[model samples]
Target: MEPGTARIAVDLLGGDDAPAVVVDGALRAVRADPDLHLLLVGPTEVAAAVTDALTPVQRARITVRPVHAAAGPAHHAPRADSTVRAAVAAVRDGTADALVSAGSTGATVSAAALGFGRWDDVRHPALVATLPAVSGPVVLLDVGGSLEPRPATLARHALLGAAYAAVAHAVAAPRVGLLSVGTEAGKGDRPRKAADPLLAAATLPCGARYVGLVEGYDLSIGARADVVVTDGFTGNVLLKAIEGAYAMAGGPPEIGGAPRAAALLGVAGTVVVCHGAAEPADVASGIALAAHLWRRRATDRVRALLAGAPAHSSPSDSIDTEVSP
Candidate 1:
């Protein structure tokens, strides 16, 4: 376990079976890591149940912040007034080192981006996930953070994925690849076509090289590309399909399936997003992931790397605080 106290604010009402799964996951995390503390954001009664279930010594490591919003509540709510918004505020206020939520992806991203602010030139932050590979770990980005992909955005994601692999996963030299239907240069749709040369021309960090293109199998087996980059729409669907395939294959490979939780990149603070349908184990992993990201200072390190990189095209014109419904 890490030494410093990693205070993670968890959204107790975020998942489909929230409060129960959140409580169970929080308990598991607390018991597994002695130095970890949690700021539970949700109903007070639910938080109390978690505390009551813990031993006296263990109870001391938890803190409950109520997000009791009466019916028909207005805007300008307090941080401890909404489960996900509360978690975001906890990080912004320095009360928590990181945050984990299995809530609405759009809502959580909007709250985090509005509360924590986006890094320079990052229009829409990407939901990045790392897959355990035989060679090393593979980093996949834009897993539903943004659906539309511009050529420049794909190039920028390459830089982000390369830096993240180096900083968070400790991959010395990462190989970045554009996700496409075929490995050939002219294989994908218009976006892939536009992005191919852009990624080729881009200067990647951490000694990373841009491999032309990789197929869907590359994502599962990890034979090609240590980092797979694509638009959030495609990445999200592909991730779920891979997970389903693993389920159909009896179970995930011994190596592991595509992760259900993803790390939000381009934000100022460490944030993790679990699948909206996450169960107890998935929630626990989300918390564990937040702790891992906080310890690694993944967000800060990635931002610093991008600050020094060459200029990309302008950020997306739409900077709306509210995400698409």
Candidate 2:
């Protein structure tokens, strides 16, 4: 809260390559931002690597919460007190302002929602990501929240995406779109068919307007919409597909393509989700995003905006779990 002194709790054992990549990312983030402090949550040894790699002055900025393990074999249920849970607890307990993890999407979301609580009426929280574009920045949401999709949820996400685009990216009047197979009026499957009208009817924040349905290419080019809303299942696959496309196209375009890092919306505290397959740079960007979010207080502002808006037209009862969170 001190201007730029953003304290972030990093999950040391949350990823496929836990400890190593997570440790490396922590080192990179620490070296890049002098004002950043990290609360490393995991085994004592893993935390030591991050602490030991830094200069004495840098090491002073880090704190470790060692999580001892049981003697028995671990079960599927997240260790009752693992690094990810500790990271979430740190945010909830005011030990840290935000958290960053390249962990299981569902585990992170569940832990954050349980620890910090969700905003009123947010049944299914969304994972939102921003992509830098030539013209400006674009906000995409429901990347991996829940799958299958309800018309109402998609519409609600449109509102979330618009506010994020305006607040985080500083776009004047974002043009929102529903991702589909084509830009035509009736170009997608059943869910898109139902959600298109819902989005059209929904009220958006920050002077955003719905631009109708857009295609996958639109996401890469950012030519159709500044805020693209979709179901978590489709959005997740689409984001990965775009990343793969860029890899095939000899790296992302100059402005960049789909991002591996996403912001968790609806939870009270700031949480960043990095792809399970993130590289050191991707993890660094995730840390930067968590810092930017905590510095801007994006979570609080977005919740405030949602509080002031009228109830969404769609029902909020169904919680789609297919999208992960």
Candidate 3:
């Protein structure tokens, strides 16, 4: 309703906690952003509970699309009438500007790709998350996108990550790095070794340059490389490890901590995927993330940038690796 309003579709059945956590998070996001609108997609009673919590004026911004489907765990492939698909449809039908779901990562990714379509020439859809680093923020990719990305896949992620840092975080001429066991070019496994040369020669948009191999420490400290590239297996493991480390050391730093939510890049629409075990606060943040992405038109810009970026290799050169959502 407001000039900068962002209508986000909430998958009420998505998340480990389901309707309750989703409801609580929707309430939090609506109260936090007056310009934010929500389309609650789930059972009527759940949607009612969300609307009931808001004031009359606030309720005006809420829209409800009652869906009837038993949402299985996140790992369950989406059923035909699942809430996540309904949420995606809302965005595609212009009822919402973005979508946020804590459902199974794979389900969300599949639904999004099928609904929004992957950008032409995109080998795989990438999940990107920004973590608070000692120096600043570090953008990490394939947090759950392509798990066993080949050299070409990593190269593609490098370009996507670089463009994201420049557009979403405003990092200028970002330094890009491939995550490896050591800083030496030949230190990593076969994937890393093979990917190194490909990334070295790839052309990154927005003045970004490849910084060669970066150790895992570089991901947290942010002293080197604005963008850290890795397969989802390593990236996801590293992300949880960093989160655990931060948890052990009192709490996350004030500058903002590792986000539990990640933006699904390479999709045609704005979609934010929260950790399946996301708490209410995490869900709220996911909603906020969706709104921010939609408001900034980050997805469209990233796609446009990818369109202009020179191909590192032909589609045949990359293998479509499946990592968990």
Candidate 4:
């Protein structure tokens, strides 16, 4: 625990089982971090569930903003009055330093972008997920943020991932890699083939080098790359697959395991999104992650690194991956 007070606005109506898991998770987070203040956004009663469980001192730190509507689904357009949107607004208005949501991925991303403008260099906002691996922590990006990033976007994510590993996770001189069908030079599909050359040439900010191609195995073992870049679809699918394996194997290993929460990068503020079907512990982890990032000033450091990137390169490129609602 960092000593600063991190006011995190939590979406009480977000997630598969809204109000309950969110409430439970909020309570767990409050107990875990003494300096954490929560802006509970949802119905008054739902927010009470969290405050009611806290000690008198802890209860004093929570502020409630009543929002009745929760985002319906990925297909439905997020309403201005939705809890997720309100949480984002709290951050933009200086009421909160960060936000955590277990809502529809589409809704959360849209809300965050609308409230906190994206960085000038980041055309595609990336969702970065960290997995505990044998070697250490492996940073995977574009995990459902942008489904299909163009070759140029992949190249951008590679650099972004490398910076995130260095600044957020403290990986020194992180090794970057492109996720491909195989580790060979020309193994993946059309997009991977195209992105390969671009990533190889792209200059990473944190002394990171492109280590050619890496397979799915490399993500778990972390023997090849510290930061793995791929399309959101592939990264999202791969993250879930690794989590499923962890569940089947009893529990995550001691070194670390799959994280249910992901941090949204490219946005101006700190934001964490949890799995749609997240449990109480999962949502708590999301809140904790948000606090950690805020304390480290990771988002600002990443933006600074992006500004230091080459000015000649056009970071705005098109991608062809299909995004599922």
Candidate 5:
């Protein structure tokens, strides 16, 4: 392996078009990065397809862990022996620096939480996505990680987003905002109203400051805030809607389109969750993202930052009743 190499464990059977799309994507990733090493966790035959496509020097960088069981469908929970779980195990066992899966988001999140263990103060792990904006990248949290986050969870996510923006994207003194129906303090439902003051009062890491409430338009324009926090259900719906809007407009902005992948935060190890319907290029991008995070040691830095952030008190009985999109 080359120096500074990043070994990424890939779930070959994690996507809608498993094995085939994965093989193509793995090939693309390996060819694109000289310092990238992939541990394919899936059936032997499927793993062979990827290695067979590579030259002798390239094949030297590929490894395989034969896991026959695939994490099929979002409804079914991931089995202990599932490919996604095996990939997580590889990371836990120090065989891979990071893991990438295009499988069920719940299954991946569950397996990662089990294998890597959650941060002590974090109850609900957040999935953070970065969207290219007019000014710069905007970090949005809970795209699908915590569907019904309590007020405390949202506050915790604010700290996560702030640290992530600084560590992952090099944003200095990121401006953080809570996603609400309007920019006013009194707008939004029960959860938003309750969480607003908590975020404003909370001590954010990386010199981040709470910028009160922001409207939906700020997510793309990113002029108001660098980090946008929201419940998973709404964030997920908004992400897809923006992606669809980009498609309708002929193509995405010159900066880039909506990300089809997101990094899982609050877990002890590096893990990336890709869109279930991810194509080859999207899968390749996910792998690249895993490599990037591992190289930057983002997970460790974010955790360290969170450790220094002050804890906030929230009502345990608080609940959000918003419908999923």
Candidate 6:
């Protein structure tokens, strides 16, 4: 194996096409990264599918933690011993450096929060997705972590995105923006108007600065900001729309298409949440993302940055939003 080994715990029963897709993805990841090791968390039969495909040398780096329960429908609460939960437990117990799951986002989030513990001063965690922009990568937050967010939550997302951009993507002096109807200061709803000033006044890490409100188009082009903050409902819709548009255009940009996976911030461990309908390539990408973040020590660095920022107070009356899983 190569140096800098990153052991990632993967939930084999997490996605819509469990076991098969997960097995293929895990096999691809192992073959691609010489330093990658996997602790497969699922049924023994499912785990066997992955191990059987690898050569003896490759198979030596694989371990299996057999947990048969899968993350079911979004509405059904996560079982205590679900595969995703077991994956999280593996990370918490130092058995793995990170985790990747193409499961129900809510279940994965809940499992991670319970297992890893949230960072201080962060009530609602953020799921951050990086889009390949024209100028560079744009970090967008709250893609599905918190569907309904208060103005304070949006500001917190700005902090998370800014730090994440710097820590993960190595963006220097990242520019932050709030997604709104227009770039004008007072063009958005109550939450945007409220968040604008809060973000402007807040202290950003890695020399990041708030660049006022930005439009949806800014997310794809990256002409205006390096980090865009919005409630999970809006961000999720926008991400899906962009992905669909890429499909309609024959293919994604040469750099890449919209990511089908995202990193969950606020929790203490390195956790990646892939789309429930993820394909083998998407699951493989998610595994790579988790390993990259773990190697960079991103979760710890981002949390430390937030620790130095001022606490954001949550408001009593917050807007509620919803999306289908």
RMSD of 1: 3.7
Q: What ranges in model 1 sit over 4 Å off?
A: 69-80, 314-325
lDDT of 1 by residue, 1-325 (tens): 5577789999888877776888898889888888889999888999998899999998999988888632112233324357788778888888899999887787777788888999877778999987776777788988998888777778889999999999988888888999998998899987788888888988899899998899887877678889999989899998898888888989887877778799999888899999978888888888998998898888898889889898754342222223444
**Candidate 3, residues 1-325: lDDT per residue as tens digits?**
2249899999998877887888999999999999999999999999999999999999999999989884465566688798989999999999999999998899999889889998987656999999988777899998988677577788889999999999888899999999998997699887888788888878899999999999888987899999999988888888898889889998888887778999999889999999988888999999998998888888999889999987545642744344546
The per-prediction tally of clashing pairs is 0, 1, 1, 1, 0, 0
Q: How close is candidate 6 to the true structure, as a TM-score?
A: 0.95
Candidate 5 residue runs with Cα over 4 Å from true position: 1-3, 312-325
- Model 4 gets an lDDT of 0.89
Write model 4 residue lDDT over 190-281, tens digit each, in one string. 88888898888788998999998999998999988999999999999999998888889997778867788999998898999999999999
The CA-based lDDT of model 3 is what?
Answer: 0.88
Compose the digit string of candidate 5's lDDT tens values, residues 1-325.
Answer: 1247999999999988887888998999999999999999999999999999999999999999999998766666689889999999999999999999998899999899989999877766899999999999999998989888567778888999999999999999999999999997799988888889888888899999999999899999999999999999989999999999999999998999999999999899999999988989989999998998888899999999998877543443344344545
For candidate 2, lDDT tens digit of each residue in 1-325? 2358999998887666776888999899999999999988889998998888999999989998887541122224355676777888889889998998887887787778778898888876899988766667878888988676777788788888888887777778899999998888998987788788777877788898999998776776688899989889888888888788888989898877779899999889899999888777778788888988888888888888777777854343243223543
Cα misplacement distance, residue 131 of candidate 5 (Å)? 0.4
User: How high is the CA lDDT of each candidate model?
Assistant: 0.84, 0.82, 0.88, 0.89, 0.90, 0.90
Better of 4 and 5 by lDDT: 5
Give the Å shift of residue 257 in candidate 4. 2.5
| Candidate number with the higher TM-score (1 or 6) | 6
Q: How close is candidate 3 to the true structure, as a TM-score?
A: 0.94
Comparing 2 and 6 by lDDT, which wins? 6
When 2 and 4 are scored with TM-score, the better candidate is 4
How far is 120's C-alpha from truth in model 3 (Å)? 1.4
**Per-candidate RMSD, Å:** 3.7, 3.3, 2.7, 2.3, 2.7, 2.8
Clashing pairs in 2: 147-323
**Cα TM-score per model:** 0.92, 0.91, 0.94, 0.94, 0.94, 0.95
